[model samples]
Target chain A: MKKALRTIIFVTTDADAVAAFNAYFNPNEVQISHFTSGMGAIQYVKQIGEADLLILEEHIKPLGAVQTIHYLKDNMNYSGGILFFSDSDKNEIYTDNEAFEVLKKGFEKSDLDRVLGLLSNKKKPVELNSKPYSLSYLINLSEGDDIFIKESIKIFNESVGKRILEIEELFEKEHYKEVSNLAHNIKPSFEMLENNLGSKICDELAHSQVDSSKLEQIKLLRDEYMNVQECLKQDFPELFKRV
Target chain B: MQRILIIEDNPMVVRSLEFKLKKDGYDIVVAEEGRQAMKLLHEEIFDLILTDLMLPFVTGTQIIEHIKKNYPKIPVIVLSTSTQEDIITDAFKMGVDDFITKPFSPSELSLRVKRTLSKL
Candidate 1:
């Protein structure tokens, strides 16, 4: 009989971290899901009934890592391994029995491997079939509901093109703040779709100063996103039939 | 059913709040701006109001003022990212019942909302 794959949920607001995490685990046997907000992660945990292992980034927006930990423990009674990754030297610590483990962000893969080893004794390499511009991330988000995946992709295809244009125009107008807000607003959509380049570019644009150089990057990202969507439609015509 | 008026501009936050509150059996009404909230307030009565301080057209403070004048008995909860000590203190003085910061836990926010409504 085939062994069941372990499910891992990671919550972080950082787009780059999501890309790295997704790429690192692409060839593994474990099932991984990403949430951009702590609250979303909490809701997923509550709905799903339990968590096997949860990795949380401290700087996650709308709810930081500490609060997420408190909620998981107090509200959901989540007693799983929670790997807390952060950059600051707060020097704070949680007792082991609380099931909270702290690790510094930006560590190498081996560092994470060691941490994973500490968390579970039966860590197996689970394989996930991932392709560039694949809908695997959206599939995970929708829990394999093809209809939801279809709608999400359709919406993304329709909106992102206009959003990219607006972002570029706003940057050209020297409306740095508006550019940042728009970029911040759309970054999650890209992250959810596993469009790493779009997510990464948006993150930078959100923090970027008002400069002409920014438009070039935005233009390049737009072309890439347009190409990815075209490829997606071509690759899965039936899935994106209405799109 | 207890009705809640959520005054928030962010669609993601609004959806999260609406989903969680709806799941808990509350009738949820959403207004994307302060003006829209005021319009809703004029047309309908809500048991409670949850608002973010920074809003368009009118402000959360202005909304509070309107509520105090027209519907003095209704409870209000302020949810925002503002760390200005005076803003929070002023809200309390202006009859705001509870204050929760951004990125709040959904369950915790629900508990606070429940506690605040229990008085009514």
Candidate 2:
């Protein structure tokens, strides 16, 4: 029988940290839940009952990391392996507890791999086919309400579809800041649609400096958005029909 | 009916939020930009405010500061895609009542809105 993938709950408010973890972990091997605050992590734990591990930043707030760890262990009876991310010199503060391991800030992939290996046995990797875009997330968000799904699609078509054109014009005018802002604004729409390629392109565009490379990214995002839009129209003909 | 002023420029997000919150039966008013939100804030009273951190004409932080100083009783909830700790911490320190990340679950949205309003 195949074993279940390990669940890792990562608590941090750093976008870079979240991006790093997302890039490192194989989805088939580990399922990760990210939360911005320790309280958010606690709420998730309360909902799911337990996870295999909890990785948190030393500076997590609302409830600090130490207090969060205590609440999870004592009040929630959580027995998961806990990992703390702190400055290399500050490892001594957490080293006192033998149960917890400290990861230095900006730890590399090998460091993460070593820590995971210590916590659990490695499972054989499996291959799976995944789509570039999926409405499963949107369907779930709508709770199977087709009307809401159709409306959201229409809104995406009208809003994001229009904004991309404006972004192109803004880039031409050298309004790099506006171009970046526009990318930041439409990013969530791509995420909501589960268009990872488009979302990733938007993330890059959101931070890119004024250069020819930024235009290349915008073109890529446009192509991806167009592809997703085409797919959505075909998948939901009724939704796309003239109203 | 409890009133919620939603300050967001994204039509897709606005539609989703409006759909769910209306189904939950709150009187919803939307402001596409921070300036419009400020005008509405001065003209009519709201029980709660659901605002995006990024907006045109005025920023969410500036709007929150205005609300904290002028309309201290109205509870504000921030909607953001930013995962930056300093921004989130600053919003809380500026008197934001709650924070909801984007691409949020509808069930969670319902629950958070209910929870925030119940505190009134």
Candidate 3:
């Protein structure tokens, strides 16, 4: 017996887009459900409880593409891939770990096929390495100046260390706004250390709405910082001694 | 020596900027926040301003507006994250001289500073 076809939720009011999608996808491989508004598409997905992918147009009634994606991902916990259709001239959309891909309007069939292939492939779980931080960025910025590197490391230890403590305290006090600002302020430190997990947490903490999840994020950041600091201390025994 | 004022709250970034620009032969003065930056602007005459958009106490936008009005001759360069496209656009509209994205190359910043100063 043939396997069930994968369902795709295409959200758009454009007749041309629907026709293009219908023409490109093989009926045997996938089934397409069309909706004119974000709300309608969202309702359909909620009712079905799952979809293989969601294709969103840049403009739609009731809610825009971004809002729809957020509602689906954040509120509904939708796990399917998302393809956003946007104008060629608009600012590119970036998400942490690239949760969605963007295809410019009037995209060719080949582009659609490529994106579909990518979306269908399951991403491999990223292996966490032993060392989650690096000094390469700082080293390069220093241009082999040991003094600058040492000073920067010291500054990171003093400032970032203190900020992490403050973030935890603020979160405990339920000062979510201050917690967010502190996260925003220290984001560059993680970027400098080349710590992706820490950076992503900071981005989430900075942008996401206030919630209990923030405390969990703060703990993660704190643990990561401690790990990085421990490694740094081991690597630079003399520096730690000086401190 | 041409002097530049860096108005940023990030110590790491401030250190990098200070290290690079000072090596490039420009005198550097640092302000850890926007209010201090505004006060420093009045007390000193700088050739250029390097500021971050998000700041404590005051904002880069307010500082830029003040510069355009009071110190129009001193060209301003903004330091922003790549994700802040809309805010960067507003900075340009407000008459900033140029912008360097965070995690920016020190060499590129040196060149931009040199170029911005040359145009004056």
- In terms of DockQ, which candidate is strongest? 2
Segments of candidate 1 deviating more than 4 angstroms: A1-119, A125-162, A187-209, A216-240, B10-13, B52-112
What are the runs in model 2 whose C-alpha is more than 4 Å off? Answer: A1-130, A208-210
Model 3: pairs clashing at backbone N, Cα or C within 3 Å: none
Give per-residue lDDT, candidate 3, residue A225.
Answer: 87
Where model 3 places Cα greater than 4 Å from the true spot, the runs are A1-130
TM-score of chain B of 3: 0.98
lDDT of each: 0.69, 0.77, 0.78
lDDT tens readout by residue for model 2, A1-243? 112266667777665676677666644466556665677567666634466678888887777788888888789988767888777465545533544667777789888787668546634322221445645445444434656767888888888989999999998998888988898899989988777778778877776665556778888989988898887777777877786
Chain A vs. true chain A, TM-score per model, equals: 0.48, 0.49, 0.46
How well is each residue in A1-243 modelled by candidate 3, as lDDT tens digits? Answer: 112256577777665776677667755355456666677566665534456777888777678888887788888988777787777464356554454567778779787787667546746321233476755456545543668877988888888999999998888899999898888888888888778877888889887886776677889999988888898898778888852
Candidate 2 lDDT score at position A94: 52
- As for TM-score, the candidate ahead, 2 or 3, is 2
Chain A superposition TM-score, candidate 1: 0.48
Q: Which pairs in model 1 have colliding backbones?
A: A28-A126, A28-A127, A29-A125, A29-A126, A29-A127, A30-A126, A62-B103, A63-B103
- Tens-place lDDT digits, model 1, residues B23-56: 6789999998988999999999899999877676
Tell me the interface RMSD of model 1, in angstroms.
7.0
TM-score of each: 0.49, 0.64, 0.64
CA lDDT of B110 in candidate 3? Answer: 67
